[model samples]
Target: MLDYSVRTATTHTPEFLGLPQGAWVQEGGPQFAGQGVVVGLIDTGIDPTHPSFADDLSTDSYPVPAHYSGICEVTNDFPSGSCNRKLVGARHFAASAITRGVFNASQDLASPSDSDGHGTHTASIAAGNHGIPVVVAGHQFGNASGMAPRAHIAVYKALYKSFGGFAADVVAAIDQAAEDNVDIISLSITPNRRPPGLATFFNPIDMALLSAVKAGIFVVQAAGNTGPSPKSMSSYSPWIFTVGASAHDRVYNNYVVLGNNLTIQGVGLAPGTDGDSMYSLIAAPHALKNNTVSPTEMSLGECQDSSRLDADLIKGKILVCSYSIRFVLGLSSVKQALDTANNVSAAGVIFYLDPFVLGFQLNPTPMRMPGLIIPSSDDSKVFLTYYNDSLVRDETSGRIVRFDAVAKILGGLNPNYGNSAPKVMFYSARGPDPEDNSLSNADILKPNLIAPGSSIWGAWSSLGLDSAEFAGESFAMLSGTSMAAPHVAGLAALIKQKFPSFSPAAIASALSTTTTLSDRQGKPIMAQRTYSNPDSTQSPATAFDMGNGFVNATAALDPGIIFDCAQ
Candidate 1:
């Protein structure tokens, strides 16, 4: 009865894993890129219209898997022909939420159409069509492709946007997905709380998934997002393959240059201020409308209140806003600030880190207008000092001010590569596995593997129920262990397609053993500790931080040796 919320692209999936399309083969056999496999996903619903889920990618006619008997639930929103060859099955289970009187039909679509973008994102990351243009805010970051683009996706919408979901509904979805004879099942969700000792394995969801394993389905789950702490794993059952989140080499960098010629690099997916011309810069508080009453920091510093802003003062200028604690608490957002800037006819925006808000990692949030965020408190201090010194206020009343601060935003559309990556993300749950509620530890390793989960770009639902910033965006960038699990699931499909007779345990063994321990820089993989503002503190990761290490999909194709555990 607890609600669980929702949690991309540039791992160059096929290329980075060394499983280049049509080139990676099993010994002397045909290409085994998940052609005949079916991946079943249990989460929020999916967006049928997304090009990632479209069936017309290949010239050769794609057909539904003969062994898969799953059906698409047709409704007004999810009309006929929603299921194509690529998306073979789609269904939603909300009876439990309805009985609990928590299901809202409008927000949580009654059909398999995803209102929350989580399911669509996860599904596309696993088995969406290959090489779909990933455009957001009129910028093309890159083309996105699933790990197993040739595989079919079967979606079971058990979780909703309003209320995460109930165990009964989740279990029901699992039973049906298993009955449908899916080759793999990917779960991007974690329980809000762990069950007591020994009951963890006996829980309805685990037990049903265990049954699926017996029936030859590979199960993969996220190793929860609460991490950098020991024994924080949510998926503990040894039968399930748990995945942790890791960083990839790809990164998008946006920068701002002050009139004083100080260029500060930051994160933002937005356009640049009119072609290298530094615009008139003014702070949000200084741009408040004449006679505006008693404005708080939320309204004046963070630019959350558009009504308080003076259009005349803000027009054609780059407004400075504070990235405050309210932003972390969900009371304020970068999107709202952007909207306010647009409403006031501001040319662009620049956000400085509020020293009060500490230890939070800022992802590259998308913006329609030209903008950038200064993530480092040190850089923010530098920028603020310059701005304050440049201000010319009236000596008598301190009311007649002349705005002199100026800066220009550079285009943040391009991506940069060659970052030392595959390092365990700070939020990817760590483990020596948890034993019980008393906080005892188990001997078995929890996260069977790690995969690229930070700053992943994938298809997004138009409804965007969980994220207001990406409401109408076709693609979004997100980071979480939830984003890591489907990667292993899709890779599992590739292994299954290659070795048709391999048991689930054997496949897991292949994935677990065939991993690389070094990063692109030829150094040992590191783990983020999340103790400081920039959160860049790192140390060589332990087995618990990155179990067995980062997955190498091509090496997994021919592991040379595989352990066959009797189920």
Candidate 2:
């Protein structure tokens, strides 16, 4: 029962990688946007309907490469025409899960259709059709284009949202992908643990990838998410080009302004309340209409259940709630809290980070109404202190007499830049190369390179069963070395397209050797150590933190030297 878990793309990538988009020439060669290359994604299935996979992005008709012979699994969810010129192939492998009786068709799609959004997102990052508009929470972030916008996608969906895929299924998917003659295979998955001794490289998945490399197919894998720690690299095989996650220049920020004129920066993609005026704030427990209700009746501070709150008392006031472990477990969500707020006609909502939920990085959640999520527990403490000081409680029975706490959410959709970027992400797996189950180091330099993986915007499945907040959105912003792998995969496609004769090792060599080590401001690349003090605590990145530094797409086109690895 060897199970492999998921890893989890997109925009501002092409220019950042220095790859030219659409009709852009590549040093006396045809457009290097992966025109004739195919990228095989081995992860959760894909969404056939995402605009990023549409084949109509070009004036000329898209034609499937003659070398590709993959089939699209036609089911009720995934129809016959799901495979187009751009999305050339689609397939699913779940015999292991089915035999093990863990295959729940109700939640995990039997077809190639993506049940979890991970596959679609990674595919879109690798080689989704160009110029798809990204709109989430009614705000347009920007148009997203892949690194190799014209590269063909061949999907091998083996992973699922309900349960992760098994090694047998993953190996089968890899074998079939290599059999289909895909130019590149992108794997955003890793084993639950390292195998013992030589088994590390002898594992079925890595062995199949070895065969793929022997067949001239490039393989890119994520360097796991267990990072900022030594020997955390998951893909330790020397044949595969492993990628680590890093930050990019673009970032979105939101803040809350208290009635006392103190502003606290936070994370959320939400709007502000009416005008600049502050509204009365009340904690969920204090606003309960039924004072006799037991604490066990509902989550007192999470605001998950609408009936647990007093609609009349909540209306025209800013409701305060807690962000807890329930959010991580999917037992509670910002979307559910927003629903509770809207049902009660609350003016806005503020979520204070629970002290219990530590080391968890909060992404910018979309809010339908005015909302703010205070990610720092310290900041949450400050907020709670202000709220308590403004509270006027009844002296006799300890009831809230007056709800005097006040605050306002500010518009948070605007994009900001000028921060140093391409720093090795804190969660991006680091290396001294991982040890086998026997605790022996592989002696290989892992995370062959680093790429933009934080807060990446990419296509999402409408059936986003993975994230409750993004269930119906067309795009999602995700972070992981999973996203980083596809960035290199797409770039590999471009390099493959430019030099059709280049071996996988040669392509990997070009990318690794031509990387840039400076940020946008010409500063040396840095590595994030921890989330606690992400901004001020970073130090200069070492080779283990960022391998050959951030990938430079343009320079890779002509690395002048290519190291050959005998397959």
Which candidate should be chosen as best, given TM-score against the real structure?
2
Per-residue alpha-carbon lDDT of model 2 for 1-567, expressed as tens digits? 354433341668776665553223573322337877899999998999999988774556457888999888899999988888888999999998999899999999898999789998999998877678889988887788877888899999889888888888988999999999999999999987775444567777888889999999999999988888777888878899999999988877888999888899888888888888989998887777676433553366789888877898889999898899899888888988888899999998999999998868888888878888998888999999999999997899877779887888887887688658879989889876655332254467877889989988899998878777888999898889989999999888888888899999899999999989999889999998886666567999988888888998888888997898777
Question: After superposition on all CA atoms, what RMSD does each candidate show versus the true structure?
Answer: 3.0, 2.6
Q: Model 1's lDDT to the true fold?
A: 0.83
lDDT of model number 2: 0.84
Q: Give the TM-score of candidate 2.
A: 0.94
- As a whole number from 0 to 100, the lDDT of residue 252 in candidate 1 is 85
For every model shown, what is its TM-score relative to the native structure?
0.93, 0.94
lDDT of 1 by residue, 1-567 (tens): 333223211336556666663324552222235778999999888999998888774456566889999998899999999888889999999887898788898888888999989999999888777778888877776788788888899999998877788778888899999999999999998877764444566777788899999998999999988898888888889999999999888778999998899999889988888876778888888877883543565656898878888999889999899999888777788889998999999999999999997777888989999999898888999999989888887899777369888889997887787758878998889887676433344567778889988888888987765766677898888889888998889889888887989999999999998899999989999999774641458889888888899999888888988998887
Indicate the worst ten consecutive residues by lDDT in candidate 2: 22-31
Give stretches of model 2 more than 4 Å off: 1-9, 20-32, 196-198, 290-298, 436-442
Q: Which parts of model 1 have CA positions greater than 4 angstroms off?
A: 1-11, 21-32, 57-60, 196-198, 291-294, 436-442
